[model samples]
Target: MKYDWILFDADETLFHFDAFRGMQVMFKRFGIDFTEKQYADYQLVNKPLWVDYQDGKISAEQLKVTRFQGWADKLNVTPKALNSAFLEAMADICTLLPGASELIEALTGQAKLGIITNGFTELQQIRLDRTGMSDYFEYVVISEEVGVAKPDGGIFAHAHQLMGNPCKSTVLMVGDNPHSDVLGGMNFGIDTCWLNTQAAQRPEGIAPSYEVSSLQQLQRILLA
Candidate 1:
């Protein structure tokens, strides 16, 4: 492997983050059928909140509560309660992305593994535990706990310190989001691999060190 340490973004990179499915499961407890239309409507409010969160305009708590506000109003429940239910539902349905486990297992003895995710703290560990991936990582840096999200160098810096201040050249950051994962890693002076599963165009001025369509490809690249 070219790097001594490999940092991953948790959600879509390692785990399947089916938010719509999670919401449907969550709302069932309240006797509501979460339809596709409703999920589309939900994303209208949720997506921008995530952007604001990564931009440091809002805190993770604010993003969590605010995204559920409309549903809370409809259900006559507190937003905090709804958010908790959503996280619990997500954890219950959590599964590793295809090839994620194999890649991690293959890299176990080759490089130190860590996670630097902008995802919430409440769900990360539980999902890792459920999927039996808890022991693979040496560090799990959650933005919610770190007080800064990805795309900000602060979270990566925090991860670096936790990683015992390893040489920047010996680190690789891999993620599904170009802006948060690739650009952030580049800005922080580390190599990055963009997992462009959707075949999205690379944004101008934000080139990653490598790009691949699947975890299988990434694993090959790393172990080549």
Candidate 2:
């Protein structure tokens, strides 16, 4: 392997983060049918909140509570309660992305693995345990705990510290988000791989060390 430490982004990079499905499942428990229109409306609020969270403009708690506030009011529940329920629903439905298991297994002895995610702590651990992926990672750095999200070098620096300060060139950060995972790693002076599964155009002025359409392809590149 070319890298001694491999850091992965949790949502969509390794796990299937179907927020709409998770919300639907969560709302069902409260006797509410979450419709596509509602989901679309939710995204309008949720998406910007995530960007703010990533940019360090909002706290994780704020993002979580604010996004669910409308729904919480309608359901006559606290936003915190709704957020917890949503995370629970997400954990219940969490699954590894295609080829995630194979890739992680392949790199087990060759390199150390870690996860640096902007996702909430409430869901990450349980989801990893349920998917049998908890043992593979040596570190799981959550933005919620770190108080800094990806695209900021601070979170990556924290991850590097947890990794025992591996050589920058010998650590590779992989994720689906070009902005957060790719730019963050690059700015931190480490190698990065963008898992562009959707074949999205690269954002201007941000480039990754590598790009692949699938984890299988990334595995092949790493093991080549």
Candidate 3:
């Protein structure tokens, strides 16, 4: 095999996390109105909590409770309601990204595939299973489970280890984020492919080995 393994990032790459839908449902059940502004605010707070949790500064459970608690405190809402609401929202809303299943199937058996992501392990698993993507990957490494997030290099190293330490030149890391996925892969000497759906330019001083606007573009690279 030219490429021994193919790694993917889950969030925006595999599926569109319907975060607003879940949040809305949770808020409605609690008789609370969730505004767009509030949703954005909470995400800002939650993102860092997750990063901290991934980096070993806090536990996964702590990250979840703290994000809800922090948002409830900021909005003067009951934390009890926030907890149940968050879970309810998470369960009700999960949308697979366009062509996600097709993409997975296309790469299946052509090269070993896996997911390297930073998110709740259970939630991500639910996504893969629900979307019928679990069968495509031999490995799925979540930062929360792996004790490190991307951009830190450790998580990338752990993921590589899980792939039996394939030669860096024979691995392809694909994801949406430049700072995390692309940078992490580059740091480990693996070729990185940036999935820039929005036409964003590569960050200065950090260039990916390949860049494509959509997952479909990968077809050409693999076939070549």
Top candidate on lDDT is 1
Model 3 TM-score on a 0 to 1 scale: 0.86
Candidate 2 Cα outliers beyond 4 Å, as residue runs: none
- Number of clashing residue pairs, candidate 2: 0
Candidate 2 Cα lDDT to native: 0.95
Is candidate 1 or 3 superior in lDDT? 1
**Per-residue alpha-carbon lDDT of model 2 for 12-106, expressed as tens digits?**
99999999999999999999899999999999999999999998999999998999999899889999999999999999999999999999999
lDDT by residue (6-115, candidate 1, tens digit) is 99999999999999999999999999888999999989999999999999999999998999898899889999999999999999999999999999999999999999
Candidate 3: tens digits of C-alpha lDDT, residues 5-70: 889998888877677778888877767788999889888888887667645687666776777887
Off by over 4 Å in 3: 47-62, 72-88
* C-alpha RMSD of each candidate structure in angstroms: 0.7, 0.6, 2.8
**Model 1 worst lDDT run, 10 consecutive residues:** 67-76
